[model samples]
Structures are given as C-alpha cells and as structure tokens.
Target: LLGVGVAQLADYTQEDLFAQALREEAAEQEQALEETEAEEEPEAVVVRRWLPGQDVRHAEFGPGWVQGSGVGRVTVRFETPWSEPGRVRTFAVDDPALEPARPLPLRRGEGMDGEGE
Candidate 1:
C-alpha cells in the first residue's frame, strides 16, 4: 500500500505532463518543418560556351587544342598547358583523335573519368 501511494503521488504520475511534452515536441517539429518550407531554394542554371586554350586529347594525333579550327577541319595546336605551342595539326572534326573531353578537375568522385563507361 505504501509503494502504491508513493507511485500515485510521484511527479511523473501526472499524465498531463507527458501529454504536454509530446505536444511541445510536435509543435517544435512542425515549426521546424514550416521554417524549412518557407526558405527559398536556388534553381540550377546551365551555360554552355566554347573556351580557348582548353585541354583536349585526341585518339590519333594525341593531346592538342588551344589553336582553333577551320572549315572541314580542326587545327589543334599541339601543346600542353605547361609547354609552348608545339605544331598545328589539321584533322576532320570526326577524326579519331578529335574527341570532346572534360576539362581538368573532371567530375570527381563519379569514377567515370577515362573508362568511357
């Protein structure tokens, strides 16, 4: 009987306290969700433009670019970013060596660099 009385008189015995705590927690969560929803998220914008002196590797003639291209041909000025202009080689746009390539610092962590996968 003593134990039952003590439990009955315990501060935690009030059911309203637990209910209020739950209500407060739920309110906090709802407020957080509302705040997150209210915040604006930026939209993604894509821009594509050809750049000069970019790195390009060809399958036939090897790495080249930085020069320019003309009618029916792409004249790649053979030279790496670290060296002077080597020689200008003309090749068809569909040439095996002339292939589009991703700039340095390629899509990291994708594990899809040169595998062509």
Candidate 2:
C-alpha cells in the first residue's frame, strides 16, 4: 500500500514539472512575439503646426486649403470637382500624407489679381 502511494506521488511530481515547463515555454514565446511586433511597428509621424489660410497638399486628396486648426486636428477644404463645393474634411495633424504646398511664382505682368497686361 505504501509503495503504491509513493508511485502516485512520483507521478504527480513529474506531471507538475511538465506543466511548469510548458508554462515557462509559453511565456517565453509570448515575450518574443511582443518584441517582434514592437520592432515591426511603424515610427510615429511628426505633426506640423498648421494655421488657417495655409495651403497644403495631400498625396491622395490633391491640393487643399486650411480652414481651421485645433488641438490635434486640422480642417481643410479640398477642391474636389466630383464632390460638393466648399466641402471640408478634417484630418489628424500628424497625418503623414499632408504637407505644405509651395506657392506659385507670379509673373511680371501678373499680380495677385491674376490679370496679365
């Protein structure tokens, strides 16, 4: 009877050790996966200060004018012929696609009125 009890005890110890080993392996794997995902994540986009009346361009939306700006967002009016006139779109200030548009140079005969002599 005592021998049988010892055998059962030994079996339980082995099972406990195996379970602990599996738990440790699973924890290690989870940590490695988290590290890999962190490496794969894209860098944060740098937000630029945008003010009202500023001209900006977007990669997909084309040219737009800044109508207003708030804490973390900027409101823009894009010239989309297919959409309603004066339609405004709001985007995150840190959007990587939005950039300041270069001003066009005016010719000698052309003024702010765009009238050529």
Give lDDT tens digits, candidate 2, residues 1-117: 654557658988999999999999999999999999989999765568998978787887776779899989999998532335666889999888998875423343333333111
1-117 per-residue lDDT for model 1 (tens digits): 554557556676677789899999999999999878767556544322223665677675555654665555666776544556578776665565466665444344444456431
lDDT of 1 at 108: 41
Number of residue pairs clashing in candidate 2, backbone atoms closer than 3 angstroms, sequence gap of 3 or more or interchain: 0
Model 1 regions more than 4 Å off: 1-54, 104-117
> Where does model 2 exceed 4 Å of error?
1-46, 80-84, 104-117
The prediction achieving the highest lDDT against the true structure is: 2
lDDT score, candidate 2, position 48: 89
| Candidate 2 clashes between residue pairs 3 or more apart in a chain or in different chains | none
Tell me, what's the RMSD of every candidate?
Answer: 14.3, 13.5
- TM-score: model 2 vs. ground truth: 0.44
